[model samples]
Target: MFDGMVKIVLAGPVGAGKTTTLRSLSDDEPVSTEMPLTDGPMGEKTTTTVALDFSTVMLDDGTPLQMFGLPGQDHFAHMRPIILQGALGVIVLLAADQPDILTMCSEWLDAIQSITPDTPIAIGITRSDQARDFRMDALRALLAERKTTLPVFTIDARDREQAQQLVRALVYSFA
Candidate 1:
């Protein structure tokens, strides 16, 4: 929402790949706020983002995209508004392997929209390849139920091209 910088936030629950996506998409190593998981681990994750992960990348047109990846746990939610204050868009990443992913996705959307209702958002369902019988239609149906349509993609958050697509789609969604 600023004049020259394009700020976007990547958000999701634990193990949703927000950090990995940031690292994958950034040319330079992201400034990560990871710490040992004294709390119980989610999946194979041994650490969690206590605050946020940050990086800046130049888009194809050379626009500077200042990306902030939010911590997945609810406890760190207080940081959301700080990261989102002037964000142009948000890319919510959901891990397909998570139980009740539909509900989680909906919650993330609600949380983001509650703060920045007009911000363009794109959804990326990560780790679909690791989930058996993951039905993307369910997510689509959930969005439909919300009476909204958003760009959604099943992506590997570890892949650069796929992560960049989510970013590009978020920017172009409002263009």
Candidate 2:
């Protein structure tokens, strides 16, 4: 049972589908800070989140969950602490097709742990459909090395069902 709102942070590298995940799970139209991409490796993606993406969804018990997605670019690192404030848990999405996927995951995980060591976390590997030879074991090994045992799922960020499943995993971690 929840009294007020439960906050969750969605964090990851550029083009990792954080915004799409929020849009998929949100009950209403999500508020986005997306701007036209100037120069980046995001390919055809014309826009990228500049500050953050926000949305709210109600759980089966009628509790509202506030989802905040942080900007993925390195330049926005300073905003991470601000966005993470009072967050109940974190959903770290990694682009499986990214060349530096492992490195990005490590960086994000480090940043998250540095800010909220006790908060629960779930890892969602987005773009799995485009990744050839996606290795779950490797990711699990990496988390094991960091001494974190989190629920990891291969998900399509645009799919409502998959996104909700990821959110549910994070919420259940609190229980």
Candidate 3:
């Protein structure tokens, strides 16, 4: 580990578990920047991440990682470039059931490529436990079609242990 901290970002589509991922890895409950979700079929009661969700984790060598989660909606896309600033890498979350997860991945890849082209990336295959009808092999093949070799694995955002392991792997890619 290095002497200073490494910053990482978590990005994905709506319902891909960005909030849950932040909650799972942070030493304490993650702090988020929320805005009201007042559009679409849902009424004005829903709140979404408007800015970013940030948390820090300390490695065994005392190096800290600042993890940030970007807002999933297109309205928040303008902030993507700023949020990725100073980031060491990214962990992209994807729901296995979402057929368009690949498109989301491509968008994220394009958005971050200029900042850190070779940045280590880890893909968290969220909702794997509930994806009863899909095969993991098929999911891997789908990812391969995008020209990305992200290390994909099951992650339960509610489980701290599982989430921590996934973050560790993402960090190790850069360590």
Candidate 4:
């Protein structure tokens, strides 16, 4: 289903778990350009990715996958297409606790798809345990309204298995 290194991009708004997802899935310690969040406090987050978060993970079949996580903040929006270039797939993570979770997902989805149209895209909803009123079905419905249906996973980005699932699902999606 793949040749050479497979590249996938993780994208979403700040505090959406892009960094943690890359960290948990990386086989080796990922190299990240995380700088202190001087702008302000983002919940428990004191650091943020200014450029990109990168790592490599080997699939069970020995295919090396290059993971590139984009900086989620809009100020760094320029990096989105740079990181997304040549990506075979994308996974957009959104925090379920955000009031605009659905809109955020829609925007990220539309943005990425517009940038890398025809690229297989999946979604991972992070911070599910923190959600009080977020609805997954509503998210699904919104995608349906957008004429897009994709694999959606509610994940704790710190968990290797859950994060890995999103990556693997994306890889197989190309097959």
Highest lDDT scorer: 1
- Candidate models: Cα lDDT each: 0.89, 0.88, 0.77, 0.88
TM-score of 1: 0.92
Per-residue accuracy of model 1 over 78-140 as CA lDDT, tens digit each: 999888888988999998888889999989999999999999999998889869979989999
RMSD in angstroms between candidate 4 and the native structure over all alpha carbons: 1.9
Q: Which residue pairs in model 3 clash with each other?
A: none
lDDT of 2 by residue, 47-94 (tens): 999999998877789888789999998898999999897899899999
Regarding lDDT, does 1 or 2 come out ahead? 1
Q: Rank the candidates by lDDT, best first.
A: 1, 2, 4, 3
TM-score of each: 0.92, 0.92, 0.82, 0.92
lDDT of 1: 0.89
Question: What lDDT score goes with residue 112 in model 3?
Answer: 71
Instruction: Give candidate 2 misplaced runs (Cα > 4 Å).
Output: 1-5, 59-63
Taking the tens digit of each residue's C-alpha lDDT, what string does model 4 give over 55-157?
A: 9877788788899999988889888888888888999999999999888988898789888998999899988886878788999899899897788999999
